[model samples]
Target: MMRKLRNILLTLLLLAIVALTAGSFFLLNHALRPADNKGRDTEGSYAYMFQTYPFLRPWVDSLRRAGALCDTFITSADGTRLHALYARATRPTRRSAVIVHGYKDCAVRMLMIGYLYHHDLGFNILLPDLYGAGQSGGDYIRMGWLDRYDVIRWTCVADELFGPEATIAVHGISMGAATTMMVAGEKQRADVRCFVEDCGYTSVWDEFAKELRAQYGLPEMPLLYTTSMLCRARYGWDFLQASSLAQVAASELPIFFIHGEADDYVPTEMVHPLYEAKRRGGRELWIAPGSAHALSYHDHRAEYTARVRAFVRRYM
Candidate 1:
């Protein structure tokens, strides 16, 4: 009986080891892969995910028409065709703004800002659906690496359409905001003036830390650190290097950091450090009193647009 029990214990141990390994592999794969709310493998799946998610659908159809939108397609460096939208000033305008949509959001969400600039302020607005999110091509999200490259292509298109000397500004919200900050960190020769980042996170690792704590009810640092390392090992992406906090701190360009006071997703504290770091770099930090992530504009419309316009007018 003792011998039989010993054999059963060993068998259970082996099975447990296999299960643990498979679970680790699955977790790491999800952490590394681009999160497509729209499933990548099927068009029908994409449509279903979009429609089922009420938070995102109405913006695509309603917001597109409200801005008098025009669509364009640009190929990425790897030959992926990206769908972009433009809401140009009805009359001539020298200032241009390129708006990037956040994770799970399409370019049309930026049309509210475009309407403000193009209609009210006569600034040409450009909005691109980032890779794996909307009509843009590509399967890997790469957090912000592949994204920054796409933004570079969009910048090239913007420069070509508007003259090289045209005043250019980039605006981003949440993931889009993080992408904008990362792209600004890159070397650009054009007179790229100001960046507007709303509810942007400090780093990929930090963002995932919040997710870990919220979902697993665990402390962030050690588990997140280990999972991030596993993510790098399994997927060849270094979350440590995927930090906009480091990038923005080192850049010469001026930035405007906007955050919602009641935000729990990215947290309001993330921007405080970024603000302190950018104190000497012509940066402005605005915190809306009672807004959530990406709702700063909706809560404080006049203040939000005024801050955005004033920042552009001052720097660009």
Candidate 2:
């Protein structure tokens, strides 16, 4: 009888371990992978996006009609073929800007900033689709971890298209913003000039931990640990190892940090610490009133554009 009891206990323990591992795998996969749209994989939920701002679609169409939008593509370090839409100005100067969009967002969705820089400000703009989003080739989103390297590659595209004399600057919003910070820390050329990051979280681990708790009502201990392990094994990058906070601290790049006061998605508290880390670089911070997440530009376009114009003009 005692032997039978011991055998049953061992079986149950094995089952429990299997359950835990399977649960963690499912959680991470669901979180990182984009949703299926018909047969195609979408960039993830933009449910709140269209309802929040419906004008984005027509605005993109308008830009296309005016001969400002041009298709561009590049091969990533990992051999992923990425896509972008280059915005040309009236004049053919080497001055250029690379505008990166947020999580699940394509370059066309960034028409607001693209128009401000390309058409209005006259900086030849190139907006690239981040890996696993839009036309870019990837199965899962790197959450700005591996993307930092991809943005650097986009700088190469800028050089080839706009030539070596091109004065280049990169600007990113949300996840793209996080990519900018990560790139600032990476080995890069001086010709790339400066960066503008808006509403980006400090690190992938921090963002995922918050979302895991808020959305799933779960803690970030064993589950996050397991997720990180799975990510490292499958994607060749660990979420915990991808820290913009650590990156920006060691970077010499001049950064323009912008955040919305009302942003609860990435949370308003994040940018404060991030700005503090890079303060010695003469980093500029803007906390827009009544703005949420990536809404700072939408809420304060004139002020936002002016700040961007001033920063790039002075730095770039």
Candidate 3:
């Protein structure tokens, strides 16, 4: 009877292990895989943007008609051909911006910010499509880990495209914001002036853990640990290693951190730690009242642009 009970316990343990392995794979796929609506159609995306922000239609149309808006491409270090939308300023200027899009968002989706810099502020802009989204090529999302390198490369491309004398700002929202912080940690060209991150999470691990809990009521123990290990083996990056907080701590360049007070998606609280982490260069934080997630600019367009214009000018 004792031997039978022992055999039963071993069988249950084996089944548990199998269940855990399967769960980890599913979790990894759910988090890293691209969404169905990845914004591949340029016209469709622009239409959506126009519907959401009515003012963009006329401004963007004018730029396109003027031949100031165009597409550009580059080969990444990994040999992936990346795509971006470049918009020249209405009038020639030394200021430029490399605006990054969030998760599952493409270059076209970020054209509002591009409009802010290119048309409103009279600064040229380059907006890149992060891998596996828009027109860029990749198998899976790297969160902000691998994308940071791609953004760094784009900054160089921006420097070349806008001229060496151009003072550039790297600005991103959500996942793109995380990418911007990661880029800040790395050595950058002198032309790269300051950074602006809006509603960015502290780290991939923390964000995933929050999502896991919120979605499935699961804790970050065996499941998250196993999933992270699987991610490292399959994609060359794990959640914990893709840390915006750690990267922010390492950066020496001035950074402007922006988050919406009502942001629960990335959690408004995450920005506090990231703001405190930056000890070098300089830092500023703005909690946009009643704004949600990446909607700070949407809700308070004039204020958002004004704050961004003021913050970047100090560093540039």
Candidate 4:
């Protein structure tokens, strides 16, 4: 009877091991591989934007009529084809902006920001569809770690398009904001002047750990550890190393940090560390009152525009 009990215990342990391994891979896949839309809905997206920001309709209509809204493409170092929407300023100028979209989001979703720079601020704008989102090609999302290299490449493209004398500011929201912070740490062209990141997390590990707790009520121990290892083996990056805090610390360029005071998705407090991480002299922080997540621009359009204009102008 004792021997029989030992055999049953061993069998249960084996089953538990299999279940744990399967569960880890399942979580990794679910997080990394979100639904892809391939940026198919230009008219639909514009309509949604117009409905959300009615003031933008006439301006976007004019841009469309003038043929200022254009598509551009580039191939990444990995040979993945990437797509971006670009528009020249009302007239030729050296001032430009590279606007990045967030996780599971496309360039079209960022047109409001594009309009801010292109129409309101009189600067050329380029909004790229990050890999695996919109029209860009990739197999999985690297959060912001791998996306940073793509954004850096787009800055070079934007500089060339705006001419040699161009001065550029990089702005991103959410995951794209994380990408912007990561890009800040890298060596970039002289034309790249400053960075603006809104509602970005300090690190992938932190964000995922928060989600794991909130959504699954699971602690970040064996599951996060196993999945991070799987991610490193497959995608060449781990959650702990994909850190915006560490990146901002290494950046020499000035940074403007924005966050919604009421934001809970990325959380309002995450911005404090990111703001404090940057070099003291070149950093600015703005916490929009009563706003949530990425809604700062939508909620306070005029103020957001004015602040961004003032900030970018100082550098560009």
What is the lDDT for 238 in model 1?
Answer: 66
Candidates, ranked, lDDT: 3, 4, 2, 1
Worst 10 residues of 2 by lDDT: 37-46
Q: Which digits, one per residue and each the tens of the lDDT, describe model 1 over residues 36-144?
A: 5542333553365365444435544554667646778988766888888776566776688888877666675565666667655788778888877567776656566
Per-residue error at 258 for model 4, in Å? 0.4
Model 1 misses residue 259 by how many Å? 0.2
TM-score ranking, best first: 3, 4, 2, 1
In the range 1-316, model 3's lDDT, one tens digit per residue, is 9999999999999999999999998998888784564567677888889998888989888887888788889888889988998987777788999999998788899988988887678889999998887888876777888999999888888888888798999999999999999999999888998999999999999999999899999999989999999999998888899999999999999999999999989999999999999999999999999999899999999999999999998988
RMSD of each: 5.0, 3.1, 1.1, 1.7
lDDT of 3 at 140: 76
User: All candidates' TM-scores?
Assistant: 0.82, 0.89, 0.97, 0.95
lDDT of 4 by residue, 1-316 (tens): 9999999999999997898889789888888885554344556776777898887888878888999888899999999999999999998899999999887778988988988898899999999998887778887777989999999999989988889889999999999999999999998789999999989999999999998998999999888988898899988899999999999999999999999999988999999999888974399999999999999999999999999999999998
| 1 or 2, greater by TM-score | 2
Considering lDDT, which of the candidate structures 1 and 3 is the better prediction for this target? 3
Candidate 3 weakest lDDT stretch, 10 residues: 34-43
Evaluated with lDDT, which candidate comes out highest?
A: 3
> Candidate 3, 179: how far from true, in Å?
0.4
The local distance difference test score of each candidate is: 0.75, 0.82, 0.90, 0.90
